[model samples]
Target: MARTASLSGFPEWLPQERVVEQHVLDTLRRVFELHGFGSIETRAVETVGQLLRKGEIDKEVYGLSRLQDDDDSAAKSDPNALALHFDLTVPFARYVVENAGYLAFPFRRYQMQKVWRGERPQEGRAREFTQADIDVVGDGELPFRYDVEIVLVIAEALSALPIPEFRLRVNNRKLSEGFYRGIGLEDTAGVLRSIDKLEKIGAEKVAELLRTELGATQEQAEAALKLATIQTTDTSFVEQVRALGVEHPLLEEGLTELEQVVAAASSRAPGKVVADLSIARGLDYYTGTVVETVLVGHEQLGSICSGGRYESLASKGSKTFPGVGLSIGVTRLVSRILSQEFATASRSVPTAVLVTLNDEDSWSAAQDVAAQLRARGISTEVAAKADKFGKQIKFADRRGIPFVWFTDAEGAHQVKDIRSGEQVAADPAVWTPAEEDLRPQVIARVAAEV
Candidate 1:
């Protein structure tokens, strides 16, 4: 069982629980590498100015400062104030800009690291959590194909994990902004922000906000609401949006891009991708295709994965880096998996074999046997104390250690399967556990439960 955190939102998993988390991280890393995304890690802290460049996330940024300062240091305001990064994308954009000279154009990279967010704690929301992100950034301009490719790559990664059914709902900012402009709404960003809250506040409340806050007419608000309601699993959403009688060059451009994404996804990932016009990623930096994913039957938990395209997030004077990316909320997904009993580790401990000490003086002999097993690629641990034979066996059993090694007075060796009461004479130099028993296994729960 996992222990409850003394401080809410900061999750600390127990050893067995950590096994599940590690398994998830390892799986993501393997899948990301297979897709040719090289791994990169940015520093935890970034200047306050750098972090705030992309969005109005000052409330979520955890600023850093000294606990004690000398008189001279306190007299002057620090020009470079720092804060823990709230997300990987902004920092990655900065990294690209800073390293533009050394990096090749159209760089592909994957980052898995902890990010701090100062938000209210909830079941799926954490103050600090791990995010697994993959992005392709290019110099000057990036291809539209990358937007579609990101969706497929993330779908493949999520499908590899033992999770419930998920849907990658996608949209394009150009489509949304153009639709708003088509209806004579000038504050497209303000309108997008309001429509983004449709799920949380509902259509009626969102329409009210658009009218009262953004000075939008009821007809304009209604048109935006109608656009937000359009959703489909294929390119059919193109007609659904067109049915609203809205037209703009940007809207048409967005429609073509989103259509390509959904059409390709239909053949590649099938039902995993959908054209969800309401997916307005609240972040201002996302300039094109935006995506938000939810686990089916657990939509209340919110997006387990999300990201979008950015045209100007990274730039140096005249050079601009356009990119498409996606990020998986690793901690949130793992927490849900464990709480719902979606999967479990086979053993709490990694040791495959526990070599028992015959006596206090036989410790050296037990070590030799353990070394032999270790050299053969088996995880072996010598008993800590020369307890009675039964006691040592009980210790191994309690830890879920399947095999226990025993040494006789004459140095003959025997191994016992604790779960099954079977003992066999074996050579430490050649004996090997079943392949499945070599390491901890992540066993998914039954289909019905999942």
Candidate 2:
């Protein structure tokens, strides 16, 4: 019974669909908390300057203005001009800076909230969606181990959800920039922007862009393409890059760091992480490791999760806060889950038992039974009308309520499992439904099918 979306990019789920989404959110929260990431929420709106300062997402930002305000009140050039935040990272960086005094060093936090964009809606793309982000920001200096940790944590979180197999394609910005520089490509960022499209476009197209747009020679462009194509699940990528004969001090440093990440992940989360050098992220802020995740067979849907290390994203006058993080596109995942029937809720409603009224005069008795059942921690509701027992059972069945309660004329109580038609005398004070029946179950469709 989900309603069609009135607006193209905004998604609205029915009660049952929402239950599945809630299960995803709850599972993510539990895993994140178990890893020691505290939850926090940032404001939905940030200044235009703030939103645009970190990433090249100005075109995606939705400006904020009150109806009563003048047309010129929300100027993009104005530092105070307000717009909805496009992602959690920028606002979180700002938050860390403003509250640096109150926050402990290397603050680990997770935020799940709606973010807005002005993209053309398509499968896995939307104007507004919920994102779940986990970040660990440090004071002045963040260790490289966190970069590796972020991948493992994300792997664990995604594994816990009822989703298909995914691979975290990871790369290091330093490694990319260093190799590009070693090959005499001065416009490292420009080359990265082109390489980021290697998946969408082909290798030839990306190399052509590198030469035409960045003024690189055919040899340099080919080298860049070769580097981008080097991908492996372990540290073998290090030798592959070295075979290209590219050498720079920064390049060596990047190789070491990236090798460390891949080496750690090979043991901790084998087959889950890959050294994908083409993952440029196309953002100017990501200074070190970057990651992009894709479901095994759904690469066309794009990355369901992405983030990286930002060494200079947040800074006070004297100190800088470097952080590593990843964000899960919760809405996009849920959309695919629902569309593909990946999982479903057992019931649309939470009521476990429906207390039926035997007659118009038995309404008070039904209420008493419902209250007693509720007091015992059962989700029980009284029937709205004194309909026939058949009609009452139909109502409960429609809502997926498994049990129905009946009060006899002699004050005896009995409960019937609508699913099984098994009726048994019971006491409202002590009767308890099976633990699994007390709440709606989020059953994985794959497992159910198996």
Candidate 3:
């Protein structure tokens, strides 16, 4: 108890900063609900076996253990048998399988929750963070159309947020894996893991890894890199990949699928989406379309939103629930907004008007005045002490409260605009601030700068 310290990866926001965060969460929820996605919340911890079902994230999983369990009992139960979930999708997949018998087919759910990871933290990547995710699952066969629709849903969601302009770079695992196969390479997964590091480790090093680790020949590595470089805002990427002279049945199928996604998304979201060949998504289960979004000028922040299609993410008996999902890195996005001043709350606190106390004797009357304003849906706060008029005004100013209410000797109320120093007589029952002044509004810095 004597030791006090701070954790590096856990992020906490200040009041004004939280205003922006809450607005982002609200905006995401509103848009998801409008799209007919039902809200769901899952438990924080999942069985360790469930967490490691995918296998690639073993190092990042934080195992849980109980402190008071007897040694013998603890030994019988796997020491690291339970752990916090690393992502929403895994836990959700398990949930669907467990509840499939009672749930409807083509179930659409949106989940906003905190997920924990024990990975090294950096800008935009944290040990603990909030993710806003949406997924559509189907009983037997999930339409490929959901893959296209998922990105469009994300594009619409991002358009409504206060973040900078962004581009959703999409690719399909089948497209990449099929291409690798057509090129006579058996280690498609290894080649993919190598190419996924294109941005991180650069082409030369990645080429070396492909040749050394995957035993890919010189021509195969070059061809893989060539495919990775073929990016287009339209469906032209289909021709670009076809022109590679590598032919396989899976390759053709993947090309047709990707073309349809890019075409459908282009007609809907226009320039917001592109068929970027480099997006491998790293995860092994992404069977179809994969997406990764980058803020136009802030690519260093990495993917602010990402997810993909998993053909067998959830299953029960002979039935498999295929799904497509996307997650918005809420903490990562909001942190950049606050750090770069990309957006800001109009006020530090929710209270828009501070009702000044005329005197200690008028406390009851002051409380009544605040009650009336609040009843009318206005954010009002009553002063705790009857300080000097000048000091009370300063109190309102310090908290960015736009208006200050003062009562005359006879209890006649007057409201003053702290910003403009304009005072006007007003009725406590009917008076309201401007529509925009009722609650804190998050303003984008680019617009504010203008």
Candidate 4:
């Protein structure tokens, strides 16, 4: 047998991880649907040109080709091959443009899909990652109300997760851009790129790089760095900066908007959001209301959610299509949560009740029990193997099946809860398991002594 090397950048999770992943996805879909965001999926391919125009030159984009083109290398380079979609937004923009004529105005759509990136894979960053995105776009112009709605919806979605504490630190691109311009910084993009590395490279290193690499003046570099590092718990941070005599109208306006967003977001999702000036989301396309959510103690996981408003991103002309959005990196969040034991599965199998198939002759009784229980909204599966009672119980226990139904000539079913080692004989139509046992009770069970 030949050995195969583990593919780089592509990661597959264990069974437990898969359970966590599904949980995260299910929660995201529920929130997205609750807020009227319909689901749409785009193919995992785009032209190299569209991807390049999207941004980030260094991103590793794996080109596609048919095996037929393997012989002719030039054939692989033909225009027919499509690049994997980098993020949901770019492909979504192209989707809206193509579907504009038939689609309704103010298109609110939520997408859950994997995106490929040609970057170094470490920790949260991966060659392939899953992102749960919700974006609102109109035919030509996007409304400001949708911007707040997008941010607010994402915050609510994340709050549903089992994380201890997190803050959705949001800032407007206009505020940052206007501040950059008013403070006499010529290259706002360049300054933002440096500020984005504030977490990675630290403030001192970022300031030095800004001055040396970006040709920023010492004072300008320091001010920008301070803004990137500056964080506040509430709108009070706005007044804190104002007291600094920042003396920039754009900065003042940014502070004002921050105040409004905090008040508004807090009114709805109180204490779930905050205004942090340092949230310079290191992206070129983001034009306003940048956001980066951070879990209190696990700030090391970095921003679990991030995105911002972009102006005229989908148009051929400069007609503003200003919209704001944030993506919950499901893969990243799930990985951290599972790795850190943040969420525990209730059961291994999706089934709550297991019906034992005693034998081929009596299998009908077990099948009948399954049908009756299922009709009652109980997830019951007939044991594929008609093994002994001990073996059947072992199978259920191994998979963390909470309740097992045992049939007898009494023409009835009995229920057993695995955890407490309790068994009760009753009618399959009337008996009920606790809420924890109703669904897949997946979790890491404590190891028994050998």
User: What does candidate 3 score in Cα RMSD to the true structure?
Assistant: 3.1
Query: In model 4, how large is the Cα lDDT of residue 321?
Result: 44
lDDT of 2 by residue, 1-450 (tens): 345688999998998999999999999999899999998999999988888886577888899987777666438678789999999999999999999999998899999999999999976899999999999999989888999898899998888888888899999999999999999998888988999999888998887898778899999999999998899999999999999999998888889999998998899888989999989997799998999999989888889999999998898886899999999999999998888888988998889999989788998888888888898889988999989899999999999999999989999999999999999999998999999999898889752221
lDDT against the true structure, each candidate: 0.91, 0.91, 0.88, 0.75
Q: Model 4, 147: alpha-carbon shift in Å?
A: 2.6
User: What 10-residue stretch in candidate 3 is worst by lDDT?
Assistant: 71-80
Clashes of 4: 11
| Cand. 4 Cα-lDDT | 0.75
* Candidate 4 lDDT tens digits, 360-447: 6888878877887889888888888889988998898897787788887667667777778788887877777777667753343222
lDDT of 1 at 198: 90
Write one digit per residue (lDDT tens) for candidate 1, span 419-444. 89899999998999999999999888
User: Which runs in model 1 stand beyond 4 Å of their true positions?
Assistant: 69-79, 446-450
Best by lDDT: 1
Least accurate 10 contiguous residues by lDDT in model 1: 70-79
Error at 161, model 1, angstroms: 1.0
Candidate structures ordered by lDDT, highest first? 1, 2, 3, 4
